[model samples]
Target: MTSAPDMTGRTLLQVIPKLKGGGAERTTLEVGAAFVRAGGTSLVVSSGGGMVEELEQGGSEHIAMPVESKNPLLLAQNARDLADLVKERGVNIIHARSRAPAWSAFFAARRTGTPFVTTYHGTYGAKTAIKRRYNSVMVRGDAVIANSAFTAQHVRKQYEGLPYFDGSRMVTIPRGADLERFDPASVGEERIRPFSLRFGEGFKVVMPGRFTGWKGQGVLIEAARLFREERPDVPLRVLMAGRMDEKPDYVDGLRRRIAEAGLQGVVELMPATDDVPALLAASDVVVSASTDPEAFGRVAIEASAMGKPVIATAHGGSLETVLDGETGYLVPPGDAEALAKALGKLHALGAEGRRAMGERGTQHAGQKFTIEAMTTSTLLVYERLLGQKG
Candidate 1:
């Protein structure tokens, strides 16, 4: 949206837990590439995953490390090792994404006397003193980036009256969707065909996220059953697709819920896929049903970007992203009846009304949220810190 501050001859190191398919990981890659494009040397340190190739392709170097480990011993060791790296690489500014890596980066930057920046990527639970202390590393930087305004508020409130509270340092930059990848026109028929063949001709709804309890996968299951009861004629099929590797017990519990609710035919737990855009393309309405308020819900934004009408719970960033009765509907969080009603409303709108809503969403997402826009805003944060260093 604005001219990116030049990164000429600067070396920026971004530390994250992993290069996985999450908003934090995506933002790390986006900013890393932007830094490189603006003439900076970009280095990403993480437990490498599927996105490593793409990061390399963007002219950034991948330094594989166990930064994702939450073990205290490894964290201390990582700090010492990273401190050495900062000195050897002559790192201009080091930024961190997750808490564990932020702790490592914090000590590393302090040890090397390097400028440290951190992004508050999630609204982590801090019910106890120890957990609050553990989460504090994210705010221990010269500059702290909050992925959304909602998150910025959380940071201010969480650390308020505490020693590290500095409201001035917190910056709100909303996460952006990659418009080019999410473009409906760019999505080919072949990409949507397989999904269509597999899950054909129902009111296809896809909730793309992990099988986490808070993500509201179980909520969606209940909503699906209710919708099926309300409208027996309409085949309501939902695909809860995301990283299904962790939390086997939670997964099993959800499977039981689906079975008990008789949502076996209505809902499917699809495994994570790299082609999220293709999955979005195949669905009619995208759902983001986080039982708790998300700091910023990228699902709603990305779904809107793909010219798809969305149905997300009403709270947090979804309030900002989804315009009620315009781009999509926002039912109350954890309210299965409300969610079911919203689902029925979208289907009742028919193809043309849904398409119109989707078209408006595409325009909204393109204007308000795109990777270029997010990248530029984040680079400015780096530039501001680098300029201070100068």
Candidate 2:
């Protein structure tokens, strides 16, 4: 919590669309909390969600506002509102996390003469010119922070015309998980036992992501069917754990497929929960079968940190997080047969091999994905930005 060298009393204003229970929102909370702990005032402005309580718990200030509005009139009003908030709070820097809020925060910071910083959380699909312009705010940060090297590459690719986006200025600060929360010791074995019981005494494959099609739920289901066909005695169960963030109809379709495939006993759908660590703890193999690449697979890193082998699609952050053949395996995206083959290889590994894989993964995660490392790199960004502003 101590101030990084050269950062003492500057106030930072973090602007996010909302404090949702996701990686981007969690990062905002952690960075703001770190700032506060470092003897600097940190204030967050967002529409607000479940993590608002966590922000407060960390002794940071939060203001509720509809920062996600894209309507021109609403955006103008948001700019004024943000300007007032910045001035009133004596904010020295404005850190925007999403495009919607970045628009308002950009102008507000400009009006207030405050430094504007942004994080490229993912590749925002921009099919239209207008959308592309909106998405450009992420790269427009006086200091842009990318969650992964993949994200940084995407940013550079997206802004190829803008020659000013020096790769050095666009920092890659990997997301960090609370090691204590994700540690095997922190989660209760008793709590995880029921989950194991639910899957029966067999190999458990867990995919924790929203129920959206892009998350590759269908791919996972197909893999499960293939696995079952090859080894009926494997007792393989696929745990689909994530909230239905969008497209409820898709979720319905997924359930119907499970039923039609006669996978009632083999597939279970669970809602999002705070006990993600425990769920990961209980899972024998964690799979991130995202069809579309993720910016940074926080779940993959967390599972690895907990000494759990992960089988993720060989794309996006998964490529960085999972040490294929050692920590886990990575099959081609949407390749159900390949995924099935990887699963079979993992299943074939006896307890000792699995344990060794898990140990290597844990060691890698601890070395590369520590909270301290993330915090330090982030603080360095802040220090450099403040220096430029000063």
Candidate 3:
């Protein structure tokens, strides 16, 4: 790994669409805090959202802008504005997290001769040439950061022969959890009590992600039904927790499926919570049923960090993060039958056996996926890029 340079007194600017509760936004904040700790000025440019205050409190300045605009004219204007900011702030590096803002940031960095960096946080759709071109901005960074080895491979295969593509420039830096916060010992019974009461005293299965089709809420619901049908005597409940408002129709469809399956009480759709670690502490098992590939599965890592067993699809970043049958289980994507069988295996483990699995997961997560490790790797990328420029 490249070493982190002395970033003291340097200015680093990160651009994202909004300071919301997504992995990208969280990573931006984590890196920004690291920048502050290294005695650098950290600035984040976003439309501003729930995490803005948190960003500011962590010694990072928030610059509100229309960087989210997809309008061509607005994007061009944003480029000019960002160029101005780059020059004025003497920004040493411009790191972009989202595609729309990355386009603007790319141009601004080029105009000012500032080092440009981008994190490919998602597996963006590029069925069309125009869409591919738009998505390519993420890889245009002087140093393109891939959140996982899976994501890095995806980028390489997707844009293999492009003139701008450079395999050596792609860096894999996985997303991480705050181990201190996610530690089971740190989360008290008080934090887990309310969720435990709501979920009731049974084997609790949790799938934490936004309410989207790709998240496989429907699959989990079906799996719950199948599991119940196979073992009618087994006490179990499935909790689907995430921001359901983004996709009301999807949520409605899921609720309808749950009702049709006679799983009204067995499957619950709850809003996304601020206390994911607490919920993980309360859960017997954590699930990531993403039908689509995740660039990096943060939920799986978080569950592992919390000393909870995870059951995720055997694809995407989950393949990289999960140790099949060791830390957790992995079934085929969207296979409710396979998922139910996996769940059965976990249930057969009993409390003590499952606790042993969780302990192994916790140890693995602490070594591989801590926020400190992620931030340090990121800073090394920044330092290397800036050092080359200097």
Over 4 Å off, model 2: 1-3, 163-168
Candidate 3's C-alpha runs over 4 A off are: 1-4
Candidate 1 local lDDT, residue 181:
87
C-alpha lDDT of residue 341 in model 1: 95
129-243 per-residue lDDT for model 2 (tens digits): 7878778878777889999999888888878766545556688889898798889987777878777786777788898888888889999899988889989887788889888
Ten contiguous residues minimizing lDDT sum, candidate 3: 1-10
Clashes of 3: 1
The ten-residue window of minimal lDDT in model 2 covers: 1-10
- Clashing residue pairs in candidate 1 (N, C-alpha, C atoms within 3 angstroms): none
lDDT of 3 by residue, 1-390 (tens): 333456897999999999878999999999999899888999999999999999988999999999998999999999999999999989999999999999999999999999999999988989999899989998888999999999999999899999988778899988988888888889999999988987897889998999999999999999999999999998888899999889899999999999999998899999999999998888899999999998898999999988888999999999988999899999999999999999999999998988999999988888788888899898998888888988
Top candidate on lDDT is 3
Q: Determine the backbone clash count of candidate 2.
A: 0
User: If candidate 3 were superposed on the true structure by all CA atoms, what would the RMSD be?
Assistant: 1.2
RMSD of each: 1.4, 1.7, 1.2
Every model's TM-score: 0.97, 0.96, 0.98
Q: Where is model 1 more than 4 Å wrong at Cα?
A: none
Please say which candidate is ahead in lDDT: 1 or 2.
Answer: 1
**Which residue pairs in model 2 clash with each other?**
none
